[model samples]
Target: MQYLVLAVLVGCVALLLAVLALRFGWRLRWLLGWLKGNVLLALLAAAVMLGLAAWDLQNFTEIEPRAATVGTLSFNKVGNQQYEAVLTGPQGNETVRIAGDLWELEVEVLRWHGLPGALGLVDGYRLHRLLGRYLALEQQHDSSANGRELLPNLHSTPPWRDLWAWIDNIEAHRLLEADAFEVRFIPLTDGAQFSLELGPTGLTPVPLNPAATAAMKRFN
Candidate 1:
C-alpha cells in the first residue's frame, strides 16, 4: 500500500515536470534530458526500495493466530530428574520436555496494533516458543538452553531478517506481565481453548471443558 502511494506520487511529479519542460521550449532542453535520465534512475531505486519494504512487511508484521486452542497440561516423571508434559488439546497432542527441577514457561502475545495493524499488516508466532519450555532457569548441562535460540538469526541471508530483528527489539520493551495468566492464542490443530500464562509460582493446570472445546472449533 505504501509502495503504491509512492509510485503514484513519483509518477505525478514526473508528469508535471515533463509538461513544464515541453512548455518552456529550447531553453530547458538540456534540463529535460537530465531529468529523464535521473527519473529512470530514481524509478529503479524506488523499485528496489519497494521490494525491500514488501519483504520487511511480510516477515516483521504479526497477525492474529489463525488457530488458537486451550489445552490441559499433564506432567509425568521420566528418568531420574527429567519430566515430560503432554499437552492434550482438541486439535492434537504436543510433548514438552522439562530437564530441570526449576523451570519457567514464557508465553508471549504479539499483535500488530495502530495504523499498521489496521492496514491488515500481520506477522506470526513461533509454535515451539508458544508451547515448549525450551529454556531452563540455569545452566546445568553441556547443552545450555539459551534464550537466543528463540530469536531469528541476524546473519541470515534474507534481506528482511534485519527488519524482523529490529521489530522484535521494539516489542521486547513492551512485554506483558500477568498475575493471573491472561488468555493467549495457541497456534495448534488441537490446542488448548484458553490462554497460557506463567508466573513466579509456575503454571497451574486448567481442567478441560467440553463447552470450551466446542467453542475452540471456530479457530480450526
Candidate 2:
C-alpha cells in the first residue's frame, strides 16, 4: 500500500512537471522542445520507479515506531530444564523441544535513511530464529548441550531472494545506512505465555499470562 501511494505521488509529480513545462513553453520555446524530446525518457523513468516500488513491497514491511505484537509463545515442561515450546507467528504454528533455562528470539531488521526514511519508508523486519539458552557459562559452551532451534527452516524460492542480506552488505561497506539483527531473551516456565513485539529499536518479549509474568520476575 505504501508503494502504491508513492507510485501515485510520483506520477502526479511527473504530470505536474509536464504541465508546468507546457504552460511556460509559450514564453520559452526551448522548454517545449526539450519536453518533446524527453517524452520516452520520462516514461522510462516512471516505469523504473514503479518497478522499484513493487520490489520494495516484496522485500520489506513498513513498521511503526511504537511496539506491535508480531507473535506469541507458550511452553510446556517436558523434562528438567527442557520444554516443548509452541510458537505462533508469521510462519504459522511451530513446536520444538528445547533445553535450557531460557529462550532467545532474534529478528532481522532493515531501516531506511535519508530521503527514503523521510518518504515514509520506516523500519522493516523478519523473523530470524529462536534458540534455547542456558544461564551457566560452562553449559553455554558445552557442545553436547541440548540448545535446540525453535523455528522451522524455511527457504526462499525463485523470485523471492534475500534482499536484506544485500542491503546489510552495502551498509557494512559504508555504502548505505541500515540496521539488522535484534534479539530478546525470555525465561521459560511451564505454561508461561509471551507476546513478541517489534519496536523501532528492537524486539521485546511481553508477558501475556500470570505464569509468564511470574517467570520474568524471577528471571530478572
Candidate 3:
C-alpha cells in the first residue's frame, strides 16, 4: 500500500513538472528533453514500486498477534525409542520416522513494533523444522535422531531472503526484531496427538487425546 502511494506521488510530480515546463516556456527544447529523460526515470521508479507491492502482497499475511492453530501431529510407535510421526498443516500431511524421547517443532518469526507495528506491519512466521530430541545430553549427541524439514529452505528463498535481517540492517532504530527461532516440544508417546499453535511469542503444543494428555502430564 505504501509502495502504491509512492508510485502515485512520483507520477503526479512528474506530470506537474512537465506542465510547469510547458507553461513557463523557459528554454523549451532543453526543458522538454530533460522532462523526457525524467519521465522515463519516473516510469521505471513506478514499475519498481508496483513490483514491490505485488511481492509484499504475495509473500506476507496480515499480522495477527492472537494464537492460531498452524498444524497437528500424531505419533505411532514403530520400534524402541522410534515413532512414525504424521504432521498435518498448511503445506499438507508429511510422515517421518523419528527416534527420540520428545518431538520438537521450530519456527522463524518476524515481529514489528512501535511505528512499524502501528502502521500495520505486525508479525509473520514460517515453520522451520521438526526434529526428534532427547532429554539427556549424551543421548542427544549419540542417538540417530536426525530431524525432518517441515518447510523447505525457509530462510534462503528469494523475496523472503531473511527479511528480518534486512530490516534490522537497514533500519537505524530497532523497529523490527526476528526471534532467532521459537520452539515447542512435547513427549513422544505412542498414539499421542497434539495441535501446534503459533502465538505472538512462540510455538505451543496442545494435547488432543488421552495419550497426549498423559504424556504431557508425565513430561510436566
Candidate that would win on TM-score: 2
Predicted candidate 2 versus true structure: per-residue lDDT over 1-110, tens digit per residue: 99999999999999999899878775777867788879978999889766754564454455667988878988999999889888787657777777778777666666
lDDT against the true structure, per candidate, is 0.44, 0.70, 0.71
Lowest lDDT block of 10, candidate 1: 175-184
Order by lDDT, highest first:
3, 2, 1
TM per candidate comes to 0.34, 0.61, 0.59
Per-model root-mean-square deviation over C-alphas: 14.7, 15.4, 12.4
- Scored by lDDT, model 1 comes in at 0.44
Q: Which stretches of candidate 3 lie over 4 Å from their true place?
A: 1-63, 144-173
lDDT winner, 1 or 2 = 2
lDDT of 1 by residue, 1-220 (tens): 9999999999999999988878887487788899999999999998987676456444221323443333455445575545565654333566665544332333322344566556865533222222222223444433354542233221222534333444555634333211122233322222233343233333333335543354345423
lDDT at 214 for candidate 1? 48
Rank the models by TM-score, top first: 2, 3, 1
Winner by lDDT: 3
Give the better candidate number (1 or 3) by lDDT. Answer: 3
- Candidate 3, clashing residue pairs? none
